[model samples]
Target: MAKKNKIGEYLYCITTKKDAPKEFNIKGMEDSDIRVMFYRDLAAIVSKAPLKEYEPTEENVEKHKTVALHILKDHTVLPVALGMVFKKMGILTSTMGRVYFVLKKSLNLIDNKIELGVKVILPKNFEESNNGKSIEELREECKTEFAKKLDGIAVESKEGKLFSDRLALNMSFLVDRNNIDKFSDILGKLDDKYNDLKVQYTGPWPPYNFVDVRIMSRGK
Candidate 1:
């Protein structure tokens, strides 16, 4: 069993740009310093963390999101999921170096782009709350509507990775930096069409839905 007090590097996100804030004031688990590890052009935002069996407790989950939000304002980041820990800095470097080509490919795909999220939610009691519209039919209609109207503004649009039965639609758009204003305006209007569906839209998020770097302490 891993020791409860073991200390390790907990990764948060990655960026292709070499320039970063000289002084990183954001933090992760235990309020430890959030710092960047650079391997050539690839840099990962990581923080020191206690490496016990980690769980997604409310506090830890909040800290993880706080770090992502802090980075999103300035940088287009590729977020690592919560609960990642590296035994040492060297493992991170080796893992990144080994997969440098793939890493770069994903970065280029989202360059100068950020992810905007849209969640289509329905009332728990669909019979009374769904306005008698077929939930699956509405989801399909929303997708078709966006493709017809907003395809020009979005670099790409795809379904969100997170899934649940109650969710009508989970999606994110890869929108160019300059087109954010136009994109958001259209999205807000699009969401309004379904009055019966309670929608939540948030954005300018790090491309967490798009990135999947699963390197652990032992370098995969």
Candidate 2:
């Protein structure tokens, strides 16, 4: 008989400490599952099950959010995207070793810091008007005008770069942990001004997008 394909489990990258909690009763889709492993300054919270049980169904994907929310309570975690895996323990260990260094550096830069995601969504009518005007005219007149406005807000808010889009702007700010409330207040003011645009913000999360890992060797 052909070997059954094992479902690769998802892993969470977490910070290490002497007092790090050993056991976490993370609520899973079907049942309560305990996180199983911890490495240097990183934890791989995983549970194994038949492929069918954790298929990439819409329901299963939503369940993963529960896992993330529960884990975030105690540890700063870089959530590994869904469907991450390795063929064996050796590969997993090697991968973790490389990831550990990158995460360590990011943690140093972001110690006691949080990542806040800010996305400004523009109205559908604004997006549809792109073809009506000459590209250069639109670029100079509308895009640049809006970008300058966003930049002023970014400067005043003292947040990160102001990313420009067709009608929206997306920005990720690395703010001190203590200043999150103040940051939210600033965002509230921006929301008041741009009442037509939708301003969505999320998190006080670990700086996942800021960490970049380049693994040179694949140790067998």
Candidate 3:
């Protein structure tokens, strides 16, 4: 069993040095102070944590997400996966050095961008109202025409899980911060056009769907 008192550096996310603020007042897991650690051009947002793996409880996950969201409010964030704990600061720094380029590339891709989610739910009497069209037919329409209209206004769009027969579309959009209002306007128009469909919209969230960071050990 891991020692309860053995502490490690818990990473929340990565951003460029120019973008990372010198201090963060947000709290992380174990209520540790969130701070920035620099390695030349890169900066890691991290906090002190136990060496043991953290359980994926609602509160634990929320604490981890809260730190990234706090950073996202001000800067472009490349959010790290949950449960990332390095044995020591040195190892954390080394891993950062190894994946520096990949991290930088991802950060560039998602700079000034935020993720937004939309799920279109069919009305209970979807088939009856829509000329007896099957759910699968509506799903195709969502993937083609509906998705294209939104994608035209977004930097990128990815299809998420439909999760249910009533869900016609589940998608995430990477949209520019400046264009959020424009995107909302377009979304509003779509919502009105499809009066019977239920649209569940979410976020201004960290670009979790867009940024991909791969951590490597020192030996590799």
Candidate 4:
């Protein structure tokens, strides 16, 4: 067993049995600082890094992505953000106990599902007629237009509203695993339809945006 530190916290990448990786390497941090734990067919790839190490620097953030990507390759990982902490094991246990049902339900819902992140990047430079519009105005216009279109698709497709249309308008979609191909096709069609904007899509990722674990205490 490893000795526990009073001020440090373990960050975890949670995953299900079908998608969990056998092992993973934690880069850009001490080997002794990281550890992996498994529980009842679920696993948590964890590391004991200090709070200061969790800053938004490119290197540190990349380390988080590195860990998440490695696990996500095989398992349906719940990628927790950097800086998650627990003061004691009891707190960790308590939080898990309180939320395990919800977590499990979410896990099952997302088991074979993969998250697809779609972003439409407007042209950096356009004619003055297009460029002079305020970002807020463009954002609202995009939200309204995209929401109407996507809501109709969602209804026809019979997928429950995972989130409000406002959130989904400029957001990610937790697509069914089997629908990835069809989803890609739709993305391509949309891209061609709005060729004026640059559309970028990423993942098949663990549903990082959806799962939330409430640790009872705050960090310093």
Residue pairs of candidate 3 with colliding backbone atoms? none
**What's the CA RMSD for each of the models?**
3.0, 6.0, 2.5, 6.3
Residue 99, candidate 2: C-alpha displacement in angstroms? 4.5
Model 4 TM: 0.70
Tens digits of per-residue lDDT, candidate 1, 185-215, equal 8877876777777777787877777676676
- Each candidate: how many clashes? 0, 0, 0, 1
Residue 90 in model 3: lDDT: 90
Model 3 per-residue lDDT at 134: 73
Higher-ranked by lDDT: 3 or 4? 3
lDDT of 3 by residue, 94-157 (tens): 7777777788788888889999998889987567334566788777876786687888889999
TM-score of 1: 0.83
Find the 10 residues in a row with the least total lDDT in model 2: 151-160
- What is the clash count of model 4? 1
Cα lDDT tens digits for candidate 2, 1-220: 9778654434434455542457665655455364556667556656543333346778776666556556555555555554444445456666777667776666566565656777766655464333455323543443344445444433222233444454345556666666777778777776786565677888765554565333323432
* Candidate 3, run of 10 with poorest lDDT: 211-220
Q: What's model 2's lDDT at 195?
A: 68
Residue 109, model 1: lDDT of 84
For each candidate in turn, the TM-score is 0.83, 0.64, 0.89, 0.70
